[model samples]
Target: MNQTIALIGNPNCGKTTLFNSLTGTYQKVGNWTGVTTEKKIGQYRKDKKIEIIDLPGIYSLSATSLDQKSALEFLTKTPPSVIINLLDGTNLERNLSLTIELCALNIPMIIAVNFSDKLEERGVKIDLNGISKIFGVQAVCISAIKTKNLDELIDLAKTTTQKPFKISLTAEKGENSAVKRFSFIERNLDKIIIKKGTTAQNKTQIADNLLMHKTLGLPIFFVIMTLVYFISIKLGGVFGGVIKNLFDDAGERLSIYLSEKEVYPFIQSLVCDAIIGALGGILSFLPQILILFAFMACIEESGYASRIAFLFDRFFRAFGLGGKSLLPMIVSSGCTATGIMSTRIIEGEKERKMTIFLSPFIPCGAKTAVFSFFATSIFGGNALIASSMYFLGVLCVGIFGRILKNLKVFKNNKDEFLLEIPDLHLPNLNDVYMVIKEKIKEFITRAGLIVFCVSVFLWLLKSVGLSGYVADRVEDSFLYVLGEVLKYAFYPLGFCNWQTAIAVISGSFAKEAVVESLCLLTNDVGALFSSSYSAYAFMAFILLSPPCVASLATAKTELVSNKWFFGMLAFQTLTAYTVAFIINMIGNIFVWCGGLLLSLIIVIIIAISLIVAVKILSKSKCCACTNACGERKCKNKEKHSTI
Candidate 1:
């Protein structure tokens, strides 16, 4: 019989790791809480018939957090044939609390003690047989990362006898229930667990002391970001140049051969310019993409990412953002779709909506590539310029966050922040490899599917026009006409040229297509740029605009309102135009001045605007609080106000 086994465990117990080992699936696994916020299913690799359901990691079956609620709903609605309760062996006493809760479900379960290698290394012994006898279920020690005894654990789970159902599913919620669970765990651990010595601070704690130091934390983050950009942009560019040359040589030979064969001009243009020119330009950055994800994998594996989140929590809360928003913003840097989905952890609808609106401000990998490419092409390979785009994106988030927080809808909704920091360990090379491999595969799929379609459409638009589908002269085409119409909308931003305007419009389809469309339009980027200021403005508009169609669809589903969806869309477009126009004006006025003068002027303008906006917002918020509370308590209310 093919058994349907459900894998459940507390957060960061390596439950997802074991699931991947059994099913050979690539669901994102991280050493952080709430990474897998939803359920996933995959067939067991050894037997196609056996299905494995990987539920979200939950500390208890109580419907408190969203992941916990999801796990409870799934099990209650569709009980599995067997349950694999993964336990962290090093923290056996704490993990047993959840095991005790699961016992009340009246379902058959086998305890698989994961992270056994770490426990053994610490000279800790867990008497699996003794615990099995007490709990009346099969128990085994297995290392999910090392793939040790997993087969035996699976077999034992498949054949284990069910424990007697005693505890009530509708157990009373109080301190008494929690005490009973703890007492039961203590009794079981007394019989099975043996410790060599008293626990003390280890290397992880020592490292955390330095890494999480309040004064040094923010600077450390900046230094790390600088290094990542240097490696991905500077080092990757060196390798990308080689790939570009290879593609260019091949394209030139193909073009010469096609001309000798007297191939049709349309066919030549499609093959040489549309396919090779457009696609090759983006593909050359593949090395940089891989390197960027690799660094992300390293940060995630090292457990420093959770620390960064913790470090930023207080500051983010000051801007009316909860700690949960940090993960979505971080994930969005990789892809906005996943980031938007990650907002499920935020229970408040108001906070979730705000997170969704702000997530697009963080440039995803595709946008990062565009920024890197333009920074190189225009600024002669300035990694600082590429990195500045991300810094600017973050600043925009803070400014916008302050404004959004004071709004009436978001007032008085302050979600609590809680997280468990995982112990530091050397990241497994194989895990890092899997992450990079998955990212590369996604990039290629998007390029082949969405980007390819957009590229073809752009070629068609530029090739055919009003004079009965003229093929060669694109200036008279429909694209030219449409670009002319949109040009005026962006005229203030100095993005008036038809080609530059067309690229921005094409970007709405897919951000990467901006570079692809631009490649198809002009052989010389300098020709399209009247001045360097316009180039920066164009990049800013693309970076700050609303996300692609796929991302918008995800936002719409989460938002569940057409009115809010369109509102967000309009807001993003206006914000992009305003920011770009401001930068363009600043750049034009300071062009004759040196770079240092321009930087000083730009900084001064941004600082003044932010200061004025914050003051106006603060006064409005104070008035709203007084109206809500009362005039007599206005002063006291302002002192304790959350919004």
Candidate 2:
């Protein structure tokens, strides 16, 4: 029978890189019972008897946060046969503390010294035998990022059986023991390992110094993000072109065939309009999303992400949110569902909840469709507005945090924000390919499984008459009833109609459904609804609204409370309505904002809040929040427990 082995390591220690190399895509991603952090299981191809569990990156087994607790539960409750401990060669002293902590579990273990190339470049060395002796475990010199001796390392892991290694737990006593460990690891490093650091090492160091600069770093970081946005836009445009052509061709051919068959126009229009035209039109963009993820996979694989977190932590901490928020926020840029799921990495309850509530602010891949459609039509593809929407999302998150800081529900909470900064290395092609493949698989599965059923159901709602299976326009469809009732309240926002309202209501299931439904509504409401600027404004309203169904479900799972989930939903809805109302009113002014203007009051209220935050609490509150980035000040952050 096959036994299990696990590779446990601190964040940024090249753990995922190593796991990907070891198991490739022979991995399973699922959920742990009662928690939101995803579980991963894979088997090493080299040894059928050896299975690999790639747990979340955690600093220590005992830490109370989600990932750390997961590690401890796995190790203590059901210890693996062997633990492959990955130690950062450059940050050995800190990484070794985790090693020391793991040793106490008496679990059979081996240490893999990673980033050796970085160590040698920094004039640092490590004695492998010395480390092995000190930790009482087999230590192998390997570089997961560089793929040096990787196969041999796996071969060594295969030889090890399920047996615990016994070691006494004692922090070597001294006022400067941690410092001493750092010094000792540095001075004696050469005895165990030799490194011929190349130019990559120098580049990482240089990048790190500049990226962490107090001021210029942020501007540079934004520029880099702008590049990512630019790429996403270009890739989306290209992919969208292909999808549009295919959709038109398919729609036309299908229409002609139905007519030749003398099929009823009602049946023909229902099949063509509701099924193929709407759903197919939206799904055509999946290629673009998958391609974007492919590029991101490479960047994340190389470990440059740690430096980004570290750099942003300086400013992020001052806002009462963990710097770890950056990753989830980036994920939100792709899709709010993915972003909400990524919140598993955040340890603090307040922080995690905050991230979840705020994540939807960043426009997701689904919203990209709406943005490209309107921004170009309205402002000649004004990149600034598109970019401004993203920043506006972040700003909204920060401002929301500021308002909630003094609330009774979130009082006196100290956030321990600390993380690992791994040495930078170029992402290997193999690893990048693995992540992209898995992400594509995930996207396909979601579309094929969850969204597929929903889309079909949505098509039915759009085809069948609302009053009970009668034939008529989409207004006669079932969604129209629900949308009409809600539409009455939205009249002031200028989109008080079922077709427009239905798309926004349906978006909560998954935001892409918004655009998908809109595609369905187009022919019916084209001239009356879509021709005006309110069309773009209404799109913006739904785009910034509450997260999708999957995200809300995830938030419920993560925060363990529906109260907060709905609370977030309510706020998101209110904000969407208010925002849409103001924007519509503003545009109408450029066109015709006479005196039917409750819109002006809404803008004034928002402006007043922004002024209050900037004038009163912006600077001080930001500085008080603990930073969980990779830095000296954030080094000792263990985990802040969430209620």
Cα lDDT listed for each candidate: 0.81, 0.67
Q: Candidate 2 on 525-566: residue-level lDDT in tens?
A: 444353355765676676668776777777777667778878
How accurate locally is residue 449 in candidate 1, as Cα lDDT from 0 to 100?
76
Compose the digit string of candidate 1's lDDT tens values, residues 243-341: 888888888899999999999878887888778776676677788778877887788777887888788876776667767788788778877877898
lDDT winner: 1
* Cα-lDDT of candidate 1: 0.81
RMSD of each: 4.3, 6.4
